[model samples]
Target: MSEVWAERQRRTNQLVRGIARKVLEGPIDGNRLYGLCRLTWITEAYDAEHPAYIRSTKIPALGDALHQNFTGRTLDEVANEVATQLERPELETLVRSHTGFTNFYKAYRNSAREWMLMHEAEITAIFQRAYLLQSDADAQLLGADIAALPSIPKANHPHLLMRPEYLLTPACFALDPRLRFPILNGAERVQSVLRRIGAADRSVPAQIQLFVGLIGQNGVRDAADLDQLGLTALDGLGRADHEPMRQLLMHVPDEGDSLPLKDEEDVRRLQQALDVAQRRVHNSMTNKLRQLLANWTLLEGRAKDCRYDVLVKGYDGGDNDLLLEVKSSVDSAQIRMAIGQVYDYWHRLMGPSSDCHAAIVLPGRPDTATEELLQWLEVGLLWLEGGQLYTSTEWLEEFVAAVGPKK
Candidate 1:
């Protein structure tokens, strides 16, 4: 057999086995399966209901339009082809005319890259345990394993961990409606896809290794190294041993994807963290807003990750909605690095309908240094602690009352 045909057979075998294990694992939820599809195929095969639901849970307008005007077969039965898997019509409509897919792809891809780095829990251990056979692997093998894994490539620069440049092409996938699978408990199904693909379990292919090295090299422009990014070169790849391919394998959706909150306790914990952050910002900012009608809101990171110590609000909200972005750290090298995060939030906040303001909650007394940063914010500075946000005594009762128990 020719080299191309042989490679195709190998990939077909891997995909078949992968799909088999995924099926044995259980019938995946439509949404989770849609996420997996984003990696495996071109189109993300979500029906009106799923995307509508996702939009509601995340963005109401996105959900509403998703409720309308999206009906395609998603499959070409005769030829077995899938189309428009990564493209969301409603979402595309919202941003396409403005920034177009080029910008959207860049932003989404960047977001995914940052997210993978954030969930850097015992990815190695998870891979080793479930897949087995990782025992006593030497440095080269371990490096190969890291390089081989597609989702998170261990870059040539070990210190940088998984660099973003290694992300695979056709970087998104949708669902295949023709196949019947169980609806996941939301992102759980996506996570399962990561595990099954050996990305979660640390299995990877060769492309990811090169991709990692390439990304690690920053932006080297050597012709030979860059030649592998074309569509034809990607045709036979199924994430068997490619480094960039592993990223495609493991890049599942995480936002607002959680199993049902099992009990009141779970709800309360989520509420407490949310409430503490909310009230602290509110009380601290009310006075500042009084100075200027700084339109603002807040966005926090997943409470679990420790990359950033705190969340803060800055002025750049949409004309109406407050735009807040989280800063992972404040002590970076650049003078404006931390402040720029706070600054960007303010810029996004100043929408057609509102004015932008800003603030950063320092873990310590940012007194003199932070004061200098405040000149950049429309909303003046204030410290964050229990007493400042509200009466020291009223905090618990107020926080709980403001944040009631879940239904």
Candidate 2:
């Protein structure tokens, strides 16, 4: 069993190195390639551990390192720093003996060197072609060719070879679909072929190990009993938060499978964290707006099953009220959702009255298309720029006029 596991590890490393080499040979910049490799290693190593271990021990240490050294630094620079730190005898000993991997550092270096040597000719040829074409389409075609390679192991799944969860590849790919690589496409589609193989011949334990690494023990009972999990808010959060939920969900064996209840709960916890972060930003914007509208009455809009972050009523004692939906950043989806939500709240509280104007308030302005959409919907747009709140629509102007000019 150990021998089989060792061989599985070797084959997986081979595939990863092959894909990495292909990318290296392509027109991709150094920063991106370094980022890809760094994330791949982190995910491969970290996912292999128990979730409890990660949450309790790994996260604190990792978080500190990230907060201290990784903040505002490029991944390539961070990778170098991490490599330098790990080379210290004391740190290396502490990591190897305590973490899930047994002699992980040594094994990783040895396997990487071995794979590079073994795939030198293939890697060279791929690089040559990549340089000759220098087009993303050509790189993608090369990936397809690599996926079709007859010498590659057919039974082993690509998900195991490249754990997408750790590298943020799935989320990055989703945000900019152009980031698609042949290796990723292969990994995503391998399960279909794997289904045809005999259950006995299939590497169920390997699959289980990869699953355990990606999702943690709480998400699954055993390797054989696995379900699909979706990381919602991937698209919404992808722009602001580079590390996305899709990265966390990429390790699921099948894309179609449903997540267990535990995984769903974990996702809920993540959503709550995001809400808190956004609220912090919203609060800052609210405070600034409140100061500006000192004479006008500012009240929180509350309704059954819904709540508005802020509502501004004019000092003129008229029915004219401004319903503001505050967001940290107004992406297209957020604006769309906010528009519907504002209408729902207004109709429930005020009941179909033109006396109230709905506006989407954001920390930053949205794109021209999103701005146009807001105008068409008759939803006013307000944003903060250079430490001042600015408005684009006539409704906002009326609301500001009621409060009078800045002191």
Q: List per-prediction Cα lDDT, in the order shown.
A: 0.27, 0.41
Clashes of 1: 53
> Residues 217-239, candidate 1, lDDT per residue (tens digit)?
21212211122122222211334
User: Which ranges in model 2 have alpha carbons more than 4 Å from their true place?
Assistant: 1-276, 315-317, 354-356, 401-407
Which candidate's lDDT is highest?
2
What's the residue-level lDDT of 44 in candidate 2? 41
Q: Candidate 1: where is the Cα deviation over 4 Å? A: 1-19, 22-50, 53-207, 213-358, 362-407
List pairs with backbone clashes in candidate 2.
47-213, 228-257, 228-258
